[model samples]
Target: MDKNRMELNGFKWPDGDVHCRKVVFSSVIDMEPALRLTDGRAVAVQAGGNCGVWPAWLAERFERVFTFEPDQTNFDCLVQNVPENVTAYRAALGSKRGRVGMCLDTRNIGAHFIDGKGSIPVKTIDSLKLKACDYLCLDVEGYEMPALIGSVQTINEHRPVIQIEDKGLSERYGYQRGEAIDWLKMLGYRVRHRVARDVILSCAPA
Candidate 1:
């Protein structure tokens, strides 16, 4: 049996960090803006859902959470850790439908990213065809631009609050550092808050 299991914030997690056996997100994605702006708390989406920690938390706030993870081992952990209200997809979120390779992080599973070269299926947030999206959080290790590009339609339609991790990792995907903020600006999302490693964007006026 796989021994990579442990408790994280009172939830089951398939521990993967060889260095610490636990990895923590900088902070939970804020849902207040989503709840305040949207008519209903119907759906939320999370990319790079390693082991399901954040998604599990989202499950309590949204009626449904659709999470995506491309790593097989991590996907298994995600499926096991997340609550029944969450739907896990074993695929990477990108700007379109396709397959790509990943640059795996053996020490920190959450750090895995696209290398543009393997068989991991890449999907777009729009592919979910959700009736409503109250919130969306993406931490794709710098491949956020493509993921955001893929989510344009959904954002245009629902204007959900979006939280993106921007630890200057976008360069790996050929995007200028901090480019996502500009992209979101064009979509009419102003930065509402800057948490530890994420920037929360919302359409709500200040």
Candidate 2:
């Protein structure tokens, strides 16, 4: 591993595994505001923050930011890189609020956890009562649905612009990318941007 890179338990998937070091953001994408966060007095949530790069970077531009990751090794790295404005949680965010087991891929630490398996301690976004979040980012492997389900209340209340990774990996998890998009549309979000495998959704203020 590189001296600057943090090591964590790898991620486990149904098809394979991956050992993720850290996520790097494009300078252009990182600088643009997803919604109306220009004044920087916005709340943001980053689900599945691998090494805190995105969240930490956004925290520098936003007033408040929150991130979640269940892997202990990743959490340790997150604590080191995340800014004080960003609150980092060493727990998974799921549809339900309870304890669950999170599977780790020994090879790629970033690919950890499947939707139904890897049960670990978690809190639903509804329980958080996070209102008025300007931006939301989710990259929770195949567990994106459950995490979105948990954040229904937050999404409806805050109407945050969401940036999600939606590759065709749904087949590996017995789901479809359309299904996820449909669910988001039903929740009143519109597809704002599509960058290869990534999908960004935005909704008007409620």
Candidate 3:
């Protein structure tokens, strides 16, 4: 049996110094994010899932975890470390369904994104069939906006708790920050918890 451990919050590899604890958010707010996974039956979508550390951990708690990463090197690492329950895909998620050129930031593996001055393949969340994700984690460099846009159907269907990395990097990737928040709000998701550069959004069951 593998030993289970919990570290404060940190990056997987290559981007080791990007500590989750050190993330700085624009606002100081505390809203309880609900992670109701007592049933042990939940789906997940980990866009830009680098090394699968967080999603792998969630797999231990949930019955099924699905992760995605476009980087080949990171995908290899994910396969080695992720548990059997966690399924990982080597592809990028976007507003459309197709392959797109990607940029590999060798220095900061976590910063990799779609290529072409800020573009990449896009896949709709509905097409991924991730309808009941209990927890959805997004760490895509600057493409978070498009990923979220493509996931509108899924968000409306599952209303899973989402943790997104929000900074000023969106503009670099041809996106706007306000658009991301507005989209989530349109889907009835509210900010549950925020820590530095990360914001967790959740929607209560109706």
Candidate 4:
């Protein structure tokens, strides 16, 4: 593994597991907003809820949480794991609004995507018109860029701290990795740190 890349635990991401259980953005970091979730009305928007690890964790800190997942199996598991404060949606966040076919990752539930023969509905963040957001976490395989593009209005309006998995750029998942960073920089968000598979970026004031 590259020195900069994190070493995967064999138990959590055993070898030969093509899409292991290792990609969701859990709120394990020590960021102030994330850590201080109990104080404010933290609203979290999760692009890919997966098995609901992030949403379950976020529900403890934030007042309200919104999570979206395209895969039925994963969505079902997510709904079961999260609390009542967490609102789960069955859809994909993309650059546009409509249905598309998503390629399923049989091994890693978190690695599913709307790539080919997706057959899933894709919607933009702008369409939801959420009132406010304190933290935004995205992990939609390699489709983070389109999802981020569709979230321009939300990002600008809410200026919520954003965390995105730069997988597509480095791996064969979505778009080029640098695309996500460049877009964030263009939007005035700064790279706060990297945790596991995602880079934590923040533009909203701390």
The digit string of per-residue lDDT tens for model 3 on 10-94 reads 4224433243224312121211233542232567667666766666666766778887888776776667667898888787877
* Winner on lDDT (1 vs 4): 1
- lDDT of all the models against the reference? 0.81, 0.70, 0.66, 0.71
Best by TM-score: 1
Question: lDDT score, residue 11, model 3?
Answer: 27
Stretches off by above 4 angstroms in model 3 are 1-41, 117-122
Measured with C-alpha atoms, the lDDT of residue 23 in candidate 2 is: 35
State the local distance difference test value for candidate 1: 0.81
Candidate 2, superposed: residue stretches over 4 Å from native? 1-19, 22-40, 115-119, 171-174
Candidate scoring better on TM-score of 2 and 3: 2
- How do these models rank on TM-score, best leading? 1, 2, 4, 3
Tell me how many clashing residue pairs each candidate has: 1, 20, 9, 11
Please, what is the TM-score per model?
A: 0.89, 0.79, 0.76, 0.79
Assess the local accuracy of residue 47 in candidate 1 as a C-alpha lDDT between 0 and 100. Answer: 84
